[model samples]
Target: MIDQEDLELKCLGLIYTMVQNHLSDKQKEVKAELESNKAMENIYVFKSSTSLVNDMQVGKQGPIATRYAKSNKDISDVVDELQALLSKNSSKEGVTVDG
Candidate 1:
């Protein structure tokens, strides 16, 4: 059987390792949540608009534009614009190599 001091030391070591593991996992979770919030912020920025582009096509199949193009080009244009803005912001923040 292990001595009392040895048992105490083992217990302390186990507790310390458990705390470290728990903290590491918690940090990862928090980081994920922060990233999620950042993406959400970017989405909010994308959606914000003015009366100028208010009539813009929410999707491709609207009424007139899609009736003519009959393609997803319009939506693709908006998505491209958003992606560009995201890219620009990331670039300004020194984030190259867009993931």
Candidate 2:
């Protein structure tokens, strides 16, 4: 016959294992959700940035070009530099930019 103390210890150990496994599974789910959210956020930011770039390209020929030609050129150059940096980093991470 099993001793009562030994039986209780075994039961406690089993419960602890079950709880640990459940927590581990929950942690994995949370991590996956966070990764998915981050990817979605990155996509949103990329789209917005590209849209801004397009708008700026158009603005170069608009009234802003005449009023602030030098400033516009400087901002366009900065945008190009940042885009190149983003492209380099994204390529290293296996992300392709369509725009």
Candidate 3:
């Protein structure tokens, strides 16, 4: 099994890359400013939307899930990212991921 700390670094790496690639530095600065306060909210920022439709057609109500981050709140950036990816990749809003 992978060390959890290593996994965490990997996750942070990915998240950092995502934020860097998709968001403007101004946005990153804004997000950084908000991070301290948002951390207190304890909201679950849902990520990773697997298409429930195809599975549902066969019979399934999904999480059909994947974990994008364990740190949920300071996630507006991630949410922004997933939205961009979805818009880029989706047809008929086939991929409905939220976080």
Candidate 4:
């Protein structure tokens, strides 16, 4: 029989999965947009398109890349902390869930 703890654990797991998926999706979208904009800038520019694209790509991606990495790490750390807490509590109380 499922209990309150089990339900809570399941919900937490689902929420964690959803958050991870959302982050992954957002990172991909951001990267795609950066690439797309860089390409569009190149296409619209006539002179110095190569140099322009290079500059634009770097300027656009630098801070965004850093922010993405930081945000990803932050999310991972939070999820890991929550997972550890749940595991610790479950083990201490001898709680087990069956898939």
Candidate 5:
């Protein structure tokens, strides 16, 4: 169970990490130029949140209701594409240290 703000933060973290991990400098520059007017931040948030909700992964979070009317398949597709992109390119295993 996650709140909307937490969801958005997760989305931002995922996108930012993926961008840092995958895109080369040239590709990043191209992306900046091509998507200058696009709301990329919101796009990530919307995509992740909608995906979780649609998949029934997000139950009510501590009496909070974070619901949306519409979910975008195109954004979900982008997420899926990103997954494939990461899998195809990523090699190093990551380590996590929890607090």
Candidate 6:
């Protein structure tokens, strides 16, 4: 003959064990997801950094180099033209003063 109070206590204990097992499984799943996310983040950082370095290396010999060279030449030409104009103006001013 099982007593009512004892039966209730056994049922509560069994429910408690089942809940604990369920919670443990859920905790493991959450931990695994967190680790997976961290690994993915690390991979993304590595790839981005590698790409940046490659781009920098390529810039020295690629289209970026051509662009920079063109810009420098354009600036030099402008500077030369300005100097020529200034010299011509100075010479005209000198002739006016001398005459």
lDDT of each: 0.43, 0.44, 0.42, 0.43, 0.43, 0.38
**Which prediction has the highest lDDT against the true structure?**
2
Supply the TM-score for candidate 5.
0.24
Candidate 2 at 29: error in angstroms? 51
Cα lDDT of model 3 by residue, 1-99, tens digit: 236454643222123322223567888687667544655244333343222223323434432223222223335546675676556556455775453
Ranking of models by TM-score: 2, 4, 1, 6, 5, 3
Tell me each candidate's TM-score: 0.29, 0.33, 0.22, 0.31, 0.24, 0.29
- What lDDT tens digits, residue by residue, belong to model 4 across residues 1-99? 235354543323212212232346777786458557843453321111111122223565563322454445545665566656567768888985332
The sequence of per-residue lDDT tens digits that candidate 1 reaches over residues 1-99 is: 236354543211100111121346777686457547843453333321212222234645453443444234544555566667667768999996353
Model 1: how far is 12 from its true place, Å?
49
Residue 3 C-alpha lDDT in model 1? 62
RMSD of candidate 6 to true structure, Å: 34.0
Off by over 4 Å in 2: 1-66
**Candidate 5 residue lDDT tens string, 5-85:** 545433322332122335678977876775554644444332232223332335443312223323344355556766654
Name the regions of candidate 6 deviating beyond 4 angstroms.
Answer: 1-67, 95-99
Query: Could you report the Cα RMSD, in angstroms, for every candidate shown?
Result: 21.1, 23.7, 15.5, 19.0, 13.2, 34.0
- Candidate 2 C-alpha lDDT tens digits along 1-99: 235455643211100111121346777686457547843453322211111223334664553442454545545655665577668778999997654
Q: What's the C-alpha lDDT at position 58 in model 6?
A: 56
Q: Which stretches of candidate 5 lie over 4 Å from their true place?
A: 1-70, 91-99
After TM-score superposition, what is the CA distance of residue 52 in candidate 1 from its true location, in Å? 15
Better of 1 and 6 by lDDT: 1
Which candidate, 2 or 3, has the higher TM-score? 2
Per the 3 Å backbone cut-off, how many clashing residue pairs does candidate 2 have?
A: 0
Clash count of each predicted structure: 0, 0, 2, 0, 0, 0
